[model samples]
Target: MPKSLQGLTVLVTRPAHQASRFQQLLAAEGAHAVLFPVVEICPPDDLAALTAQLVDIATYDTALFISANAVDYGLKALATPQILHHLTLGAIGKKTAQALQQHGFTAQWVPTAGFTSEDWLALPQTQQLAGRRILIFRGAGGRELLADTLRQRGATVTQVDVYQRVCPKIAVSQLKQHHEQQQLDIIAVTSSEGILNLVAMLDNPAWIKTLSLLVGSPRMRETARQAGFDGTLIMADNPSDEAMLQALIQWAQE
Candidate 1:
């Protein structure tokens, strides 16, 4: 007689623009969605620099997109449209490739399994990067692991900053009220940055000691631990909404 997430209250900390779909999916399964957006996705301050990178985009041998956000926001910064037709494209996963399709572009390469840079790097096409020039479109403050690995493989990797993440100023009273009243059941964190932001917002309370946490990956779990949350973290198979919901259901059943 129980729903998958019946009577459970889930707190999702994804960016405001990106939270609606995930909330809808959780709500469909009978979980009460608590929307507390901690991050604001915005345009980078330096538009000129973004345009400068795209000015010579056609010369690059490959262009890599880190996320769907990157594909949507990054391509519009280009100086011209025809340049995309000339370069080989790479997407981190299916959603990003879908975003590219919306933009009338296609990725020649995508990581088949596992949607991380480590997984993408495992592809045979990525191994032969010698003398290749790659343009990476992504948000600011992204990890250097991908670019670094590509450079070490004898590729010229250029990164264009498309968007920036700004942590919003959420009132502590709201979070404390939910925590005090026990309305906040599980907090789903999508990224390492989101994990740290949630820590700063909640101020590392004793409530976290009893709280159930959901992380998109093991990397996020380690980051949450470093942020003073040593509580148990339920990890999703991947970062998609479906995967996170599946993890949530699995945890609830246990």
Candidate 2:
């Protein structure tokens, strides 16, 4: 394949653990990957609350994993194997589904494209969730679109935030060094939290304006704009690494 992303230095702002695979994907497209993890995934402050939810996991008719982090943190919180196996499993996207599958649970329902809560709600399985009990596992303080929409559709939605996402503190200095070098070309901002953290981490205003933003959704583009980042907003076909890579290739061709 032609290397369209050749010589481009892209900054990846996902959680550090999750950044490697995406960095590798970018490398395959001939882009230089800059490691700048904005969000750090950690256990929620209230362990007992998560524990209580896991103990009662089987009571919900459907278990929805909001993200791959949710699958990692939520499944790890489970005190028993039986209850988890009995409940119907669903994942938000292909990555989340793969994460669940790796943990020995197959997601019976997964959205084929458009990896968002609205996309999941559009599926036939989710459309029939009326009168059903749905359990959502995600990080603390994210969007309530999924649970709220499910309730409006007549499903009883129970949310259990199993993990917490906070900005990692150490990347600021490294980002300053990169800014001085004018090394960052393309920036991949996956979520609102990541965008916020990235904006906070970069000290130089010129650096923020110089780099083009590769956002997962239009929502993220708005978040980037609000943070005073007056850069080009490039939306991928989907939030997947493959889609972002294709976007990068297209951007290079343009």
Candidate 3:
């Protein structure tokens, strides 16, 4: 509301559906928010297989969601959402937990401090698992850290892919046009895959490497570095839209 980001141009690389709130946040501060969606969220290829798994949903001791998309799509795959009430529901972040709440399910465990798998695994409740049946609902090709660690703790972790992320086809000239006009200030990406897609979308990304880069997590920042982005890397405390906006405002003030 203070116009803290006045005159700034921010390149938002989140999926189109998730970019609107962040765009509004930037616009509220008088910053020019550019929409350049790098990732597209879609249903998994085998919806039948995903739906079939829900038949035995009551067999699992616990159900964990990796993201809000997982919560939405995963629940939709179920024939009877009420069947999930018996399981110990867990969410990786507050947002994911909130998503479950919207559908009348309460998450018994959600990390108060961090959103990563390591943070969730650090909980004493997760570490003491032995012969626990854990079901993970997530997008395709996500990190295996959570499931792998739970398996090590003697839990039978079954991961189900509810959604898949693919890079959308967009013209490189769109970003190039902005860069050429010297209108680009900062580029914000939330995921490792998004950052990679951003780079791949550009025909020549050398100029992007010089602009300020804001990322949601350390993993995303590291991915940017790996992709040859040597810009000023700004890490958000979390991937939430609010946290990302706060990080952007803080960087602008600095």
Candidate 4:
């Protein structure tokens, strides 16, 4: 009888700490929230490369962070205050920028509206990457559009993979068992990688067919469509918890 999500079950695929707030918001809307973390955040094994890059941090004209995780893990690797003050920081979105600000770094540039590489590239600051040295801190394996475009503009780009995101190997069995039992109703995927990992774990077409997917962005929606997900693919305008919760509530209501 409620306008909010009542009987629907929604899955949250964000990291453990990040998932809780979204879960609470969904619960407030009366949807059953389930967490199925597709990726676990871990520090990179080799900091030597990152350490060397930081030595010349002051030389770089700009620094970029692709995700909030990058701000979290990348800031932790810097052992001193001096390195933090050297370059102008840029973030892909408000959330990532906020994380940087929380860690005492102020971002001079952020995407105007959309939280994607294409949006960031359109910023006036990104126009003249020529002759500028740029450092990008992010998780392992992501879009290279920004880096490639910067290089095309004659910027010397250095990428530091500060954190690694890997699907939990142990979750495979647990997810399979849950799927068999039909315990999962809606599965949320924030990244394209998370969707791929979910598909990889559940190779059975029939099982994957039964699950509804909620993606965080249009980029991820494209990924799901490409991966043969013909069912409804809901999109969150951004990756923030509020955006995700709102999308989940709307999906549940439908």
Per-residue lDDT tens digits for candidate 4, residues 85-186, read 778889998888888888888988998688888888899888877688889998888778889999998899989898998876645676667667777778
Cα distance off (Å), candidate 3, residue 215: 0.9
Most lDDT-accurate candidate = 3
TM-score of 1: 0.95
Clashing residue pairs found in predicted model 3: none
Best by TM-score: 3
RMSD of 1: 1.5
Tens-digit lDDT string for candidate 1 (135-179): 999999999999999999999989998999888887778777888
Q: What's the true lDDT of residue 94 in model 2?
A: 89
Task: Rank the candidate models, highest lDDT first.
Answer: 3, 1, 2, 4
Stretches of candidate 1 exceeding 4 Å from the true structure: none
- Work out the TM-score per prediction: 0.95, 0.92, 0.96, 0.91
Query: Each candidate: RMSD to true structure?
Result: 1.5, 1.9, 1.4, 2.1
> Over 4 Å off in model 3, which ranges?
none
- What ranges in model 4 sit over 4 Å off? 1-3, 172-182
lDDT of 4 at 237: 85
